[model samples]
Target: MKKIFAILMTVSITYFASSQSKTFPIASTLTTIDGETINSNTFKHDGPIIIDFWATYCKPCIIKYNTLKDKYAEWQKRTGVKIISISIDPASRVESAKKFVEAFEWPYEMYFDLDSELISKLNNGSKVVPLTLIYDKDFNLVHKSTGASVLYEGSAKKGVKHLYSGKKEITDFTVDLSKYFEIIDQIISK
Candidate 1:
């Protein structure tokens, strides 16, 4: 009994220490919007990188992309961070997805995960749209959120409020990009 207890304690400590130092898997291969294959490691730089998982048909995802498109340049300049937007749309919708991306004129790197390879690697099995993952300069997974609203203050609750409002529902939603920038600031400062 004493020997068994000692072995269990050793395993527990090893597991805890490993879990505490989790890093992002930057070796996964993902395709660019231009159909060029590339590895996620290409995004790693001297600063943090934000990977946004989205779908073409997802309304909230569209809102988040639009908001990010407007502020991407400023955010890049200020924080030296890069945002990689990955589309998890079906293969049949690849053309449509390209059209949508072109319409928005997003100045960030865009990729299509038709087989969900990268998404599966990042999300760990659960598939959800508008998922954002932030990785530090060393490729460590720093922050992750399921929805765009979570990136900003009160945006999620505000969307819920509009849904329950006794008036024509507002379809337009926006997030405070400054909040996201603040996150980059915090991660890079560390």
Candidate 2:
């Protein structure tokens, strides 16, 4: 009987921990394109937030950013959503990353994670580029994708295409922002 009781207690505790939502590591230190230091927690938006982790040399990451940029304005105006593009480039490539951002004229909030501290915290130390985390207004991490994902319409069914471990070519792939907006809407409505 004692063993059974102990097992039950352990199960209960594990369930409780697993069921809890995780918040962003706002305390993590990150740098801006201008080399200014700031705590990540300072980023707050009126609604849901999207954080994309990318590097200057990551092709898939670049494709995702460009695709998202096409519909970013509409997404923001409709949902008040904020997208933060965080470059995980090393210190040596910081200048290049800045140049890339400038050359593209990306309007989203941009930051630099030189040491990947924020990425490690959010992705359990996985060094995968093009990872995206979606958070609700309360900063609870609601959805995370490790690779490129896009919604597609085929055969009368909508589908999601996912590529992982940087193995897929994203030259022709485009993420469906509508699906992301649907997810945001669900989270915000809850």
Candidate 3:
């Protein structure tokens, strides 16, 4: 009985300890829009960090980026939160993505995962863009959200494939960015 209890306690402790420390692909290599290369582990900020995964072809991602750009200054001023934009655009679209970023003049640090290597590791082999990840000061992931879509019931059924086509208007889909902002607000308040 004593040995069984001891073993059970050890297993429980191990599980909790392992679960608390969420591991990311911190060593993954990424390239800046300027063509400079860096590792994911090099990201450093004074407070919380928001790692936003997006792509040039993702309309929902474009909307999210636009909204974030407008409020980025205020968010930084208030909470010291740093927004890191990770473009999950394929190698073929790298030039377009860089051009778009330069033309828009987004206020956040921009990086590219051309091979989807970083994003795949981060999202369990799912390379879906427009994904938002917020980490606390300690770099432990606290929140994650998949951005706007047309897949919701009663909404258009075009899905992400349509967004990639660039033929349909994105206004048909509902863009709700409130949840991400709310989560960021909560993390900063903490």
Q: Pick the candidate with the highest TM-score.
A: 1
Candidate 1 lDDT by residue in tens digits, 1-190: 9999999999999998765533455567777888888876556456788888888767668767777777778778988888888999987998999998888787777888878877787788877988888888777788888865522233444563553352422235566556677789999677
| Clashes per candidate (backbone, < 3 Å) | 0, 0, 0
Better of 1 and 3 by lDDT: 3
The true-structure Cα RMSD of candidate 2 reads 10.6
Candidate 2's TM-score? 0.73
lDDT to native, each model: 0.75, 0.78, 0.77
TM-score of each: 0.74, 0.73, 0.73
As a TM-score, model 3 comes out at: 0.73
Q: For candidate 2, what is the lDDT?
A: 0.78
Worst 10 residues of 2 by lDDT: 151-160
For model 3, name the residue pairs that clash: none
Candidate 2 pairs with clashing backbones: none
- lDDT measured at residue 7 in model 3 versus the true structure, 0 to 100: 100
| Deviation in Å, model 1, residue 186 alpha carbon | 0.5
Better of 1 and 2 by TM-score: 1
